[model samples]
Target chain A: PRMKLVLVDHNEFAQAVAGADEAEIIEVIDHHRLSGNLRTKEPIRFINEPVGSTSTIVGIMYRMREAAPDKSTAICLCAGIISDTLHLTSPTTTSTDKEILEWLAGIGGIDSAQFVKDFFAAGSMLREHTPDRALESDRKVFEENGWHISISQIEELGLEEFWKRETELQGALQALLTKHSLHFACLMVTDITRHHSVLLVAGDQRVIDAIDYPQAKEHVYDMAGVVSRKKQLFPYMSHVVTKLDAP
Target chain B: PRMKLVLVDHNEFAQAVAGADEAEIIEVIDHHRLSGNLRTKEPIRFINEPVGSTSTIVGIMYRMREAAPDKSTAICLCAGIISDTLHLTSPTTTSTDKEILEWLAGIGGIDSAQFVKDFFAAGSMLREHTPDRALESDRKVFEENGWHISISQIEELGLEEFWKRETELQGALQALLTKHSLHFACLMVTDITRHHSVLLVAGDQRVIDAIDYPQAKEHVYDMAGVVSRKKQLFPYMSHVVTKLDAP
Candidate 1:
């Protein structure tokens, strides 16, 4: 018997569940930039949409199947949509996302505005984590061309707060570089109020030189008006590094 | 005022509808291999699916909107699905296509078996046309790497009948190559009964030479068990052409 797999939220072997390479992927429902040259011996259902959240695509899949999600499932998907789109303020939010959120919110019979406010209040506790814990939270690794890179993003209320932790954060990033055998590791500390970010890096010198962005210090660079890491930071640096002569 | 466009079945500036270059595209719904780097100033609804027919994706769109197609539209979409998938037997047909076809067939009150028999019988009327008309009936142009090529597929009852018209068909293919400024052009004469095809070629002898199959003539080769030009012939040759050193 063949082991069958169905991936939700994420695709790509490097980011998928453990033992994914040994299983046959039956379907993938995701809301991310399609990456990795995944080949299978059989055809698979791959639904990747440019939306705010994977939850939005999953909602659509449920609707297409003519099955209403359970109460808890609907609320969970609603939270995912709200979190990923940042209360509908992120540029990554799409009209379809807005529509699905409305449907899910109505099904859950909850005030989404109140829920989002509470969600933000809870997310602002980033000050509690040490630099290492902060880096481990919401971390993702990607392979751009042949360069394997890890990028993590965290939101802070104030730029000064992150700058104070710079030395400790840089140490965590360097540790990640060694642990993952990565060509590069980047951490984006975005100020929620100002909609600007400062990126800290630790990687191969060649990878650092390819950024196109002016570094504020030896390993930190300012990125203005960039809030979404997947949409902005990863794509920007990935294009630059792949165009460079070598990693 | 600005021109707004909605492209159906096809995308890509090179192969888009004429006057598309002068207009701003607002949406693209297609079912072919996704190609071209199309970007816009604003977000648009771009739906590209791995279904057998553009009609299959369109059918899902109609279903998602909760609006049923009229009888004529239902029949039309059903015919498209049946034709493109060769009655759900083509390699390109997906489970989604089968689902859409069944729904459309039910709505249109069609006996799919009878419809498919009539469809293929109608498709095998290539001998009634002059070679020029036959070539123009189902011509499609593609861009691979930097090279542009046109391919036409026709269903015939026998290989000998198509061989008799080879000179005249080659003339038509050469005209298409000159008119479209294509790097190459190919005509696939498929035997509907025997499930074999003889591919005739024009322009860019390097591309023809690159086909792994042994050539039966200067520009003709035997292709056994090959149907679905988009899935089989175009992809196979595109891989070869793109892998070559240069055009």
Candidate 2:
């Protein structure tokens, strides 16, 4: 049977679940840039807002309908907001996100400050997983100007673990490039506590040389106060690819 | 100064007002197919639903906010609903449209049946306006597979006015094709009462030949029970344009 789907977090089919192209997309509630490729046989309800997280939009929807989620569901929603907005510190954080987070936190009976602390400490990607697995976590691929690129992001409490496995992570990025026949592949390790990140890239030399961010080392750049892949890194990378000399 | 725009009814930039490319689009409330070109520097509220009329969505929004429009506004909304959905008889009309129309009619103290009748009889485009003016009214341009096409629609009480000016409308469509350098241009004259339309087309011979609707004359096709430009004519024309052999 064909699945009837209501996509929540993302709107682009590339970021959606596998076989999403064949499935019927009945509705979409997202908080991302319109990818412009989504089409439906019939008009569907689409609600997209510019906020820190899709969770915030969902919470707003519930309030509009004069309803509230169950306690556990509220907690899950709170977690989503915290993770996406990094405890309301990320630049993508909006007034709506702040409002919705407070409402959900009250409903969930969660100490949001403690939840943020515990959430960041729960799983350190560099410590808990191999470089390959870390790179695959929360990864997104994009096609721009006929070049296919992949950008993977992993958030940790600090950058301590990233320095330890720098070489291995770079190797994994290279392997990813070859494995996927990508023009470029990048893994952004973000420190949520400090609002900083380090990008390790492996790709064509021309593309790499086009990097405008201050280089910390070979094939690595220090991205200070940059924690958002969607808001910060992706657009920068797209600009680089777009300005490159035709292949 | 760049205007901050709140686009209602339509989302595509092609159909938007001039200088829209330079303006800031802060919000959109629409019920059309996503044209995929809309982008914003900041996240904005976008609400799109598959409904017969944007007035229906506007009415629902008013209800959600626990508010009601004033008398004149209510009547205007009712007229929008009646005109777009052809008095709740178009195939595109949804249950929500019916519900909202009834609500607005009650609030505005409207006789919907009489209003619909008077509205259709008020301005017979074929009789009152020149062919050029008639074709430009309620017209939409679309680009598919490198083919730029225009489809203009005019609703009247019967086919009497259309038969009187078919040749002139055909000439105007040809002029529109040349003026815009379009691949094809069509004028759909719909008899709202009978729920039928006749399409007068002029453009590239290849594209003209590909249209499969039963020909009523040399350059006109009979379209029975077709009152919707968005739901019926646009998609069929798009399919025809997309399937033509590569130029």
Best by lDDT: 2
Question: Using Cα atoms with residue i matched to residue i, what is each candidate's TM-score against the true structure?
Answer: 0.68, 0.86
Runs off by more than 4 Å, candidate 1: A1-51, A67-76, A88-118, A123-126, A129-247, B18-23, B40-43, B123-125, B128-130, B145-147, B156-161, B214-218
Q: By DockQ, who's the top model here?
A: 2
| Model 1 fnat value | 0.02
**In candidate 2, what are the lDDT values of residues A87-170, reduced to their tens digit?**
899989999899889999999999988988888789798999999999988999877777788999999888889999999998
- Residue pairs with clashing backbones, model 1: none
Position A186, candidate 1: lDDT: 89
Clash pairs detected, candidate 2? A36-B36, A50-B43
The CA-based lDDT of model 1 is what? Answer: 0.79
